[model samples]
Target: MKRLARALFASVFLSVMLAALLSLAPVLSKHGSGSLPVFRVEQPMHLTEGTLVDFLSRQSMNMRLHHVEWERNSLTLDLSTTRLTNERYREMYLLIQRTLTQTDNVESVRLTVYDASPATPAPLMTVRATRGDLRKSPAVQQESERSYQQYLERFFEVKRY
Candidate 1:
């Protein structure tokens, strides 16, 4: 009777362990199989109008930019997203790069997409500065702001008779 009870207890424990392992399988697979490199904004990207929030939502698949760390000439962004496919991730990366490149404070936008696997840890993209790239000088920043204001004024097309 004692031996039988011990066997039954051991069987119950094994079943419970198996159940737990099975439940965790999907989560582990996702984490291991499709992990992607996260992007970081390395400068204070003074967004024009509502573009900043819009950009983040679209790029990170509605994930909010939780934290921002500012350095001397750079800013690091902590962004979160649910789960993105390779194509979606690439599209988001390009969109950010394009937007940043359009800004004066952004000298260059580098996108480093991490591999989906640990053995192949490499960035998928590395955008470099193009020629005639506006330097992040104070004058350039001021000029850019002035230009944006002027553009907005023109865009509104308010007439003075």
Candidate 2:
């Protein structure tokens, strides 16, 4: 009876240790430097999110992008700020369109910016553009105009002077 109990206890302890090690393996590689993850090819969404975050952090215009989601052929970025400006919108839209449109995997990109001004409820402004539309000159300009209009409508609410 003693021998059987000892064997059982040893096996259980070993199994638990092995399970813990296996679970922690993936997390161990994520905490290091700016070095690109070796497993990026297997997970395209992670690759995209990491790249965008790095790019935004390096840019002059401050952007607080809270969430990034990749669904099917689309990537969505959720950005929030106390205030937003015209130049910020232009910079973000151009950067995303220029960078992601060239990639083979993504077809559409949507940027959802939330205005977190203190007086009123947060207003949302979404701008969506396809890869083909971004590639065309007229379509790109149109999309930019539309995005700017949407931003003005949502936050500024341009009243006729």
Instruction: Report the C-alpha lDDT of model 1 over 57-141, residue by residue, as the tens digit.
Output: 5453343344543333333444334443544444543444454554455433333233444564434332232213323223323
Q: What TM-score do all the candidates reach, one by one?
A: 0.29, 0.48
Error of 1 at 58 (Å): 9.5
Give each prediction's root-mean-square deviation over alpha carbons: 19.3, 14.8
Clashing pairs in 1: 37-114, 42-74, 42-75, 43-75
In candidate 1, where is summed lDDT lowest over 10 consecutive residues? 152-161
Q: Which lDDT value does model 2 have at 76? A: 75
TM-score for candidate 1, please give it: 0.29
Global lDDT of each candidate: 0.45, 0.61
lDDT per residue for candidate 2 within 10-83, as digits (tens), equals 99999999999999976776665546766666333333655656644554546577777877867777766676
Q: Of the candidates shown, which would achieve the greatest TM-score relative to the real structure?
A: 2
